[model samples]
Target: MSLARKFATVGGATLGSRLLGFGRETLMAAALGTGPMADAFYAAFRFPNLFRRLFAEGAFNAAFVPLFAKEIEANGIDGAKRFSEEVLGVLFTVLLVITIAMELAMPLIVSTIIAPGFVNDPEKFDVTVKLAIVMFPYLMCMSLTAMLSGMLNSLHHYFAAAIAPVFLNLTLIAALAYGLWTGADPLMTAWYLSWGVLVAGILQMAVLYAGVRHAGMRFGLRRPRYTPNVKRLLVLAFPAAITGGITQINQLIGQMIASTKDGAIAVLQYADRVYQLPLGVVGIAVGVVLLPELSRALRGGAVKEAANLQNRSLEFVLFLTLPAAGAIWVISDEIVRVLYERGAFSPATTATVASTLAIYGLGLPAFVMIKALNPGFFAREDTKTPMRFTGISVAFNCLLAVSLFPIYGERGIATAEAASGWLTTVLLFVTLVRRGHWEWEPALFSRVLRLVSATVVMAVSLHYASGYLADWLTPQARLLTQLTALMLLIGMAMIVYFALAFAIGGADASMLRRNLKRKPRPETAQEEADTSVLPPPQM
Candidate 1:
């Protein structure tokens, strides 16, 4: 499949998942608000979510996919199956051990690491510990799910793996609905949500496992062993793990700092959900599709092909991300009020969340660029360099957050995250250029500049449009009225952006259409020969 079609498959599914996620968050807002229950539930949830990113989605895939793709290319499906079984055995064993250890340590982790603020409230703290323990096994389930997903992506079976997350959002949304119907108390409602997370993990794993099987690959776990290929995967994965770990730590730092203030954590989570819609759809979709495609291209000695893929991915990302960032920045308060200012979520909380969303929006492009660029290094088996940059970014994040938190409160932490994201992005780009792995062709640069210009136009349009809808986008307004106005405002901004982009030659609708319609060419003999010798495993 062509990259665009693959991305569309993944991006479309991700869009579904994210839309459901917004529904889940909206229900959560109505149920928990920015209160003690909300704080405890989100804090507990963050622990497993952090590990999911570290071990499942972020580190493991970066290291696993390229090697997995190479195995399939070189040794065919059977060889790939055997390698997968060995790796799965080791991964399962390790994750099981970690999950058990974390469950036992849940109390300490909650009090000291996850939410120190809750320590003063013994009941709340205890609830957090229990919720975290219930959800800890989610890490195990999802790590295994991620392995299955990596396999599917390498096999070019994107839809099932991509759609799997929808189950999670659905599970949580159902849980909330049940709680609301039962008129459950806040603590009981949180308990239901926590269990919902665990059930979702299991369902997600099942779906992806079925996907792997449908793709005509099956592997049973054996006793964990350090075979050569497994050892090499671990070596590459360790640095990527550290890189992911640092990113998580940066987030934890922000959460920890935010925790000191009542309701701050929930506010940050709300804003995070808002910005993550775009990030998940565009940035993550690009990363997921780009990694395996780049691996195949580089392995086939198609360096030019690899570079072009990176450039095109960047172009497509900015095309969508720039206008998104601008619109969010321009109408953040309205979006927050329309989506979340109901029940316990007050206008004041909406304002705070809006500011947080705008700060995050400014960093959206950099965040997506990081996603697009990291695959370049990962495909080349150069994980350590990114790890080093991540370390630097983390250190800067801590320094900035600590320095600014005392002065600016939650916004300070948000600022630090945005600043660190850009730092990591710039460092990655410079390194890629120095390594001769990426270059800014004139055409790509021009489109990016044009996209920025178009976004500016959209921003101005949105700023004016938002003023006219200000009354409807308020807590006093009827919910339906707010929704209608918010949708109309967003639709108008999108139209303005696209129209301006097309006028300025920034929009390439034809390129997207052509890419979607393009068919995969058969591999030539030279291409086969070029990929025959896999690069030596980095010990």
Candidate 2:
């Protein structure tokens, strides 16, 4: 499959999940607002979500895909199957250990780590602990799902893993619907969401397991064993997990700091869901595909192909994310109000979330670029370098957030995260260049500058369009009226950006066709001649 198609497959699926997630968040705003229950639910959920990214998605994809590809190459499907079962047994056992420990320590964890601020509110503290315990098992389910997902990605079956997240959003939405239908109180609504998370985790795993089986790689349960292979995977995965979850780590750091203020955690989460649309679509798609694809290339000693893939991935990411960042930055207030201003989401809350969203918008490209760039190291089995950068970023996030939070409130945390993200992105990019792992193409730089120009134009256009819609986008406007205005404003921005991108040489149809469409390998000189042309611009 063409890289663009692969990205589209995953990104399209992620786009579905993210869209459903928007509905879920909208419902959540109505059901919980930024109340004690909302803060408690989001804060508790962040723990397992953080671990899911670290242990399952980040760690396994970084450490497992390359090694799994090696197993396939060295010993075929059977060896790969054997390696998978071994890892699964250990993963399952370790997850149980972690879950049990976490469940037992939920109270302490919540009081100290998850939300120290809740301690002063005995009811909120207890609610957070119970909810966290109920949902901690989600970590186990998603960890197993990640193992299955890594296998599927290595085998080039992207859809199931990518689409599995839709179930989480679906289940949560259903839960919210039920809660609203029953007119459940905030506390009761939160319980529904927590249980929904657990159910979705199980459903998501089942989907991936089915995908793995359909891909013709079946595994039998094995007794827990710490084989040499498992041990090596652990060594690699420990660092990779940290590296893979730098964003989550930074969020958790922010969460702890934000918790000191009531509703700050939930406010950050509202803004987070908005920004996560582009980040999840473009960022997760790039990270999921790049690692396995790049690993296979390097493993076969196709260094140039690997470099080309990285270059193209970077280009494609910027093409999509730059304008998204622009739109988010330009109309953040409208976006927030249009989506979440009804029900318990008041105008004041909208203003707070909008500012936070705007700050996060500035970091969108860097966040996605970090996902694009890290694979350059992980694909080569150098997880430690990225992990070191992650550590540095986390430290920076902590220091900056602490220094600024008191004076600036939640916006301070947002600023810190954005700043930290850019720091990590620059560090990763420069290191890749210095280590000769990346080849800076002159054309790629030229295209990026052009894309930036297009984004600036689009931002200005969006800014003016938003101003024109200022009246229609108000809190007193009918929901449908507000939504229509927001859509038209966004539609104008997209039209302007894409038109400018093509007219100004930032992108072209031939480039899309070249990257998104694949042709059969030519088998003859005449065929090769017919196929001959300048390759698509990298990314």
Judged by lDDT against the true structure, how good is candidate 1? 0.87
Model 1 ranges with Cα > 4 A deviation: 245-247, 514-539
Return the lDDT, model 1, position 489.
Answer: 93
**lDDT (tens digit, per residue) of candidate 2 on 185-206:** 9999999999999999999999
- Against the true structure, candidate 2 has what lDDT? 0.91
Q: TM-score of predicted model 2?
A: 0.96
Candidate 2: worst-modelled 10 consecutive residues by lDDT: 530-539
| Reference-based lDDT, each prediction | 0.87, 0.91
Query: Which residue pairs collide, candidate 1?
Result: none
**Model 1 per-residue lDDT tens digits across residues 1-539:** 66788888999999999999999999999888899899999999999988888888887668999999989988999999999999999999999899989998888888788998888888888998999999989999999999999999999898998999999999999999999899998899999999999999999999999889999998898899999999989888888776655546777889988888898889889998999899989988998999999898778776656777887888889999999999889888888887888878888898899998999899889888888899988898988899899989989999999999889877888899999999999999998888678866888788888989999989998998888988887678898999999999989998999989989989677657653332333454456456545343332
Give the 10-residue window scoring lowest on summed lDDT in candidate 1. 515-524
The alpha-carbon deviation from the true structure for residue 261 of candidate 2, after best TM-score superposition, in angstroms, is: 0.7
Clashing pairs in 2: 312-538, 312-539
Model 2 ranges with Cα > 4 A deviation? 515-539
C-alpha RMSD in Å of predicted model 2 compared with the true structure: 4.1
